[model samples]
Target: MNRPAALAVLLLLAVSAGCTDTGPERTTLMVIPAGSLLYPLEDIEAAFESQHPDIDVRIEGHGSIQAIRQVTDLRREVDVVAVADASLIPDMMYRPMPEGDGNYTDWYIAFAENEVVIAYTGKSIGADEITQDNWYRILSRPDVRVGFSNPMLDACGYRALMVTALAEEYCEEPGLFEAIIGGSFDPPLQVDRTDGVAEITLPELMRPAGDKVAIRDGSIYLLSLLDAGGIDYAFEYRSVAEDHGLLWIDLPPEINLGFAEHADDYQKVHVTLGFRRFQSIGSERIGLPIVYAMTIPADAPHPDEARMFVDFVLECFQDGWPKSGTATVADKQIFR
Candidate 1:
């Protein structure tokens, strides 16, 4: 081979190696969202990535509390944080960072809403006979197994406790909470009443006394248990149940925590986390209408990308891009 031809061949090999090493430069945007948002966010991620080939969106799902803690407590370099409960942003993230100059997050937008429901499969113990009106009674059966997320970790877990307590008054059935939930734990989840308000105290470790109750880190984890027939029924978000195509009995507006008009009624129940980690923030969690929210952390590594992603999500909600089955988008006015 001639010298010029040999040099050309060597140059081509070097160029090909460079191209393979760096074909496209992509900026990664890290997102931590509540477990319930996993499916919908996956759809969003696909659409967003297609539109912005230069940006890669990475998502990790955890219980809303743990999702925020990944930033505020663990000091992870998360760009965006979303949660199932709107109040958690202020309750857990509004405080000043342990080593930073500002709060973990300064602002959050409430984007969607959801309701708690009992999800079960054909194999559920009372699947043939359970109804919204008698769900608590059915769950109380000694032979039945019930599942919920850990209250100290997931918003839905605490909401499940609240719903059961509220059902007593709404269904005119006394001791329903105790019959189904309270009495199933080892130390027992205890409830105290003052006037019309019911405050439920959760033990640090909510251990099930027997095979009657199953608890996981996030509500989404319960879906697999329901599918495997590990639990007769599971308390899940209506959006999650619908997304997974599971059968669910919708509770009344007052107990479902989905209706803003029932906000005052929902406020009658509260959950107090007994974990020492929550002592700094005051562990009491008041029941409110379920609202989904998101924010960019103050110390986010990719602030510009985080803002763009948040705007994209809000626009999707406004345009009904998440679809109806995942969760109900908040009013269009809120997005404006």
Candidate 2:
């Protein structure tokens, strides 16, 4: 009887321990991502939690630059970092990857692709005139309002300029960049040309020649404005536009920086900016198939759980990349 009672007590203790509510002891996941990925990340989070009822997920959205800062500057304990700018993981985190040595971020997986576009609500000024053939003309209108992300903080910001520069090559209009982006200032003006190319000073924000361009931390950050009709059109990525259900004009791949073949042409207009703690982010903007890169941070609280979350993201990338339903992770990578 004494042995049976002891056994029963032990069994009761084990059952009580299992039933105790000390808050879940399961590891939680923290993911920082480009603002554009909010939607896909939502789907992933729901699926992840459902699969592993014990794990908790916390996701934060910011511009790619901001996301990098969460680790590099803010020193936040981010389990995983995903950015629309795949090269950023290599450029910013590469030194940390080799770990014990000086590798900041190693072996990131490029899992998704996107393209640039002019996203807008139909209420945009001269919506009737904003065709692919003459989108610039409409954007040049003083009443038209356009916006882009701050190049210093967002990939879309730099990509917007790349698109603007490429637009000149496509349209053969010499003053287009100056007129469209350079001209969108509080005090509008004409540019003086020198040595064939015109030079104009812009606010660090790079306002459009007219009041036409609006800038933000990330392209998707403008979604609310577009929805509320506070602003007209904005430079955004195709994935962002589709995800938000905003009307958009699809820029040609050559100008949109979506095709890998035009990488050389896209690299012509390089931008170096000061964002985050870096002394300066001096990366040449190249037009390759837009791919997103993700990595698990070295000091994530839930390293194993974060790895599980990363697996889910890679799975999503396998399908969601290229906006296609199916593509291998290797296919999505631009510089593997």
Of the candidates shown, which would achieve the greatest TM-score relative to the real structure? 1
lDDT of 1 by residue, 26-129 (tens): 99999999888887776567656655667789999887878888887688999999888888888888788888578887678887778888999999999999
lDDT of each: 0.79, 0.68
Total backbone clashes of model 2? 21
The predictions' CA RMSDs to the true structure, in order, are 10.5, 10.5
Cα deviation of 226, candidate 2, in Å: 2.7
How would you encode candidate 2's per-residue C-alpha lDDT over 173-275 as one tens digit per residue?
8778756776666564333344433223334444444346667766656877777776788888887787677788877767787766666666555544433
TM-score of each predicted structure versus truth: 0.85, 0.79
| Shift in Å, residue 213, candidate 1 | 1.9
Q: What TM-score quantifies how close candidate 1 is to the native fold?
A: 0.85
